[model samples]
Target: MASDSPVYLLLGATGGIGSEVAHRLADDGAQLVLGARSEDDLDDLAAATGGDAMPLDATEFEQVQAAVSHATDTYGGLDGVVNFVGSVLLKPAHLTSIDEYRTQIEKNLDTAFNTVKAAGRPMMRSGGSIVLMASAVSRTGLKNHEAIAAAKGGVTGLMRAAAATYSGRGIRVNAVAPGLIGGGENFASQMSEQILSSEAGRKQSEKMHALGRVGTPEDVAPAVTWLLDPETDWVTGQVIGVDGGLGTVRPG
Candidate 1:
């Protein structure tokens, strides 16, 4: 980050975790350029956070690049960028269609790729951070998560490689991998919520985490912002699990 009050571009700004991250940044006095698929949601979030809103589909490279440029152009420079863009698919490979898999890849991995490509040169100007959202399933085996797991696994790979590629330039890249975030008002999380629609499913999910509960937007937002913090600039190429130990522990 260039200064105390840096400019940031937040993709998927209307999502549950994304919205929380925006307000957290706003509280820290960071000027924001918010981008999301829905213009209406973007406007509402922008108004609430006092940020400029840009409607965009993150799977589109040009749109994402335009967003980066908008952030730099509007605020003079971009100090950080975060991609909260992702998808949730809970189906075995046998049940997943090609189109479904493609959509999954586009939503999670391609968005991350486009974001890193778009932000590289701009942030390279003075060095900044890029945080991406990954999933615990990418590292830990979770049945029926094949499609999403593969997509997010690619995100993890991108985060590390980009971190290596940009480290000398002082740009940081990292990811927050969460497990079963219980609530969110986004396309992806809504799909994820379906898995918990049943009491049996909900109880099983809660018990899957060693902490005896699922996570929330509040549980995940701060970690994203912390990685974006200039204070933690030295941290890079890492996947921090905010997963209630689901990715590492099994409850006894």
Candidate 2:
């Protein structure tokens, strides 16, 4: 029997949006296994969320598989999984290096792939939810976003295909595609930070979103949390846009 309290494996749990999801899940009384490359950050999150900390490198299949195993082993079942592992690269195809392109694929696409591949084993038995972070740039044409767009486009495809492949087994797969977010490890450390650093660049980014400003990790957390909730079991194979109308709307 599945435990009344769901068990969730959060890859990249120390990142901006990931930490928010972890806290929300913890508040909802979900059992969590927090995974990330930094053991210290993971330990801190573990203390705050009351979850076990498992140091993880999401790009490696074995490590992701182990995290999945840890959750099931500790909690008796795995109910949901979300991979917040990603990267942001702002460069045109003409200027992007092959190594940089490959790194983007590895960090964003490969990590999400590994999460779907590994989490399938435990969750298939009792049915669960899986969410991967995607980007609005995948669907919209954004300048100098070549490499990351390609990778995130692959994530969009991977989610759709994996959702189809896993739906019958009772596992639901979804991706949340967010827009130009300003705060968090993702935006703070990446080219996004560089863009938001300059007044002209920041306003340009804000103008890109119909909402008239940039976004925060807080804007993204609830969408993921909602998908992970069992109450939304009927929802699957969908790409939810938490992009502040950036992907599909034109600003006035």
Candidate 3:
């Protein structure tokens, strides 16, 4: 990337949606700092996209700091960030354990907090953008999505508040609330045999979207990339949904 080219820090680079966003930004000739816990996945993605890979554990504060520091050094300054670290626990609210709730909160909220704090450091230099991964569940209710929904709600709130606080300093904060993005091992891992096997469950999930199909990572990737682009200079402090009109009628 040239001195004038935008630099983007992409967290959760191993996941389906994150990888797509990284590729999208790279395609637009943006310099990328890809962060994920899986070194091999990060290496492969970075190599394929001509970006640098940073093995970062989002939960580890120092690790995140180090990765962002490396990105700032390599890119000369930060221009944008896409945080995609999130986890989901699928269980009825009554059956969900406290530990399971904590896991989702830690994975979604804390990881995002760490990445934003770290990335905010160098982003201040160039007046950058920050895109947080939220969920349609944040704005709507669901059966077994309690933990993730609560955490993502917090994420959306955090992004809005951060946007207000940071905009004066030239950093824009926003969130993408996606529907059921069908790609990524993360989403597949959340799907259960019980849910797939039960006809009612399948129908309920499928019908929630007006589009009659679940979302794909590719479907949500463009929204994430566009929000992080410098082109969206005036857009900030908003939680835009990538769902296919689910939030409008059926709160999927």
Candidate 4:
């Protein structure tokens, strides 16, 4: 059975989906330790959710370890962890620069690796859950998404391996792969002005999903929360798509 108040460490707590998940977890009676690269953002979220805040750079193993340590120390124990650290690079393979490829790997894959390694130690002692973020593009071919797909693909692979290795220790690992989510200000910033401003471009992107619309941060938060909950203990090593059928279906 799940604890009445599960202690969870949430990385990238300031992002669109992360923020939404933080709030939902808090409402669901989870004690949260919020982490992000920006101290100001962490402080703000900490205040809003009544959670402790830690400055974290998920790409660095030591920082990831420290954040996990802080969560366990502050809350007496850690029950779950959710990582929302990732980037989007809309460029074809040939057009993608070396730097862009490296950035995507560091932002998406490195963060997942560090989070799993650090969190696994404490979580192994007491059964817990870990959730990482992937993307629909990892399983589906999308134009101008080579770099992001590669990085998120690595994330999916990492999550599955970690889940298999640690299940014996009572650790459950899973991932949520979402489609293009709308209403993310930071995500919008990553897009070209033309894509953001063009009505045709926006409509085309929406039509890619079987739902006939883009997703939102709200669309993903519930799934993350469910995976973290102890009630879903039987589920692990799965890459559940909260992608509005984007990965499995094509709208005619």
Candidate 5:
């Protein structure tokens, strides 16, 4: 029941979850500005969803700023922004290289930081909602998830502080922490290949979730869209888990 045709700027729009969010928002009567690293991919998505597409590298502040400015200018103003940029590094801290650690920080924490800073600047005068992607690992201790956990943990902290700083200005900032979402072309594909390649491995992963299964991009898009919707104007600074109980429950 979304109205007003709110304008939303979406980063990582070509990714699995981001694509789903774009389609969901479009169906909700949203006007979307989609950003991603590949112009062709963005173009395809834009064509499919009737959204505007731009090439963006979220880690770069200037590019992010440009994308935000474009959205604001094109739509007259921006009503929301969703950042889907992130990376997954599942190596032990001792085994992770400095470069890998830096990459993780840049992809997760830096992407979120730059998106907030750039989007916040424009949305400052006219308040809007901002949704960021966090991970269940940020709150749960998972083996070999040291690097990504640390990075997404920073994202959670950033979301909270930004929410607090902007709430009074009518800006709402929140995050969605997802567990192992399969059927996506992302870093998780590597883990999915290993964890879902065998029947036994698949069962082991399914048992990790109370729901007895992993998630999909479709399962996550609704929560993100809800956060962006006007009805949730009162909710901010919250980290919601769309993890099928993976972060909270232990199957006995």
Candidate 6:
């Protein structure tokens, strides 16, 4: 008989990246707790994947706590938590408002904070994977990405710090910094705009990477799965870039 599959808690399951990750994990035979602000979206994802679904507002602490409890209570334990909730606020930094700044920070960074906190209890008890989504722009400068860059940079920092803090407890924390992943709702419109606006825009963006194309959710999900696998027990405190050679390029 096959071994019982471990369960994973997937936040932001309604999102393009999060949904892709959820499907990939499900295909690999993981039971899941799918959470998002939209009950409709979560319900649809859960039905499609045969996973448990819960409506969660990552911005609300009580909601996150409740969601985590539901997952643990339902599954007996959670083997991983993917903090894939984030925002990409693109605009001139000076044009950004105090409210916008706060909202951006809360939307992108605080969700991770609360999710990690709420999930840590079950994760520590069982020794599991904790994956946070960072971004290549956290370390690289891109126009109109100041707010998001700052928020995601905090995520990278949290990954390293949490990895160090939680290692002894058997909870491994890691991050994936992806550059220009296509087919996600977050970037679909912008990507389409950029791709169709001009041949020069497409060429310039592609030339920025050695791989000559943008990445996809599938391109990034494997690394996450590997990191969470028992095979990678020795790997921790690492941030892998799924940036399609973008990080390795030199400006000439």
Best by TM-score: 1
Candidate 1: Cα lDDT at 127: 94
Off by over 4 Å in 5: 1-4, 184-194, 197-200
Flag regions of model 2 displaced more than 4 Å. Answer: 1-4, 184-191
lDDT of candidate model 4 versus the reference: 0.87
- The global C-alpha lDDT for each of the candidates, from Candidate 1 onward, is 0.90, 0.89, 0.81, 0.87, 0.88, 0.79
Write candidate 6's Cα lDDT for 1-252 as tens digits.
Answer: 112788888888777677777888888888888888778778989998888888878889888888878777777877888877776676779999878888878977898788778877777876888888888778678788788888988888888888888888899888888876665454323434555357786677677767887777778878878877877888887888988777656444
Give the residue spans of candidate 1 off by over 4 A: 1-4, 184-188
TM-score of 2: 0.96
When 1 and 3 are scored with lDDT, the better candidate is: 1
Question: Candidate 5 — number of clashing residue pairs?
Answer: 0
Prediction 5 global C-alpha lDDT: 0.88
Alpha-carbon error at 12 in model 5, in Å?
A: 0.5
Report, for all candidates in order, the number of backbone clashes: 0, 0, 0, 0, 0, 0
For candidate 1, what is the lDDT?
0.90
User: Model 3 RMSD to the real structure?
Assistant: 2.4
lDDT (tens digit, per residue) of candidate 2 on 1-252: 345688899999988888888999999898889999988889999999999899989999999999988888778899999999988888899999999999999999999999999988778898989999889999899889999999999999999998899898899999999997777565223536878889998888888889898888899999999999888989988889989899999998
lDDT string for model 4 (36-145, tens) is 98788789889999898888888999988998888777777789999998888788899999999999999999999999999998998888999999989998988888
Quality of model 6 by C-alpha lDDT: 0.79
**Per-residue error at 91 for model 2, in Å?**
0.4
Residue-level lDDT tens digits of model 5 in 131-222: 99998889789899888999999999999999999988899999999988788665345445666767897788788888989888888889
Predicted structure 3: lDDT: 0.81
Which ten-residue region of model 6 has the weakest summed lDDT?
187-196
Task: Predict model 2's lDDT versus the native.
Answer: 0.89
Error of 1 at 68 (Å): 0.5
Question: How big is the positional error of residue 18 in model 5, measured in Å on the Cα after superposition?
Answer: 0.6
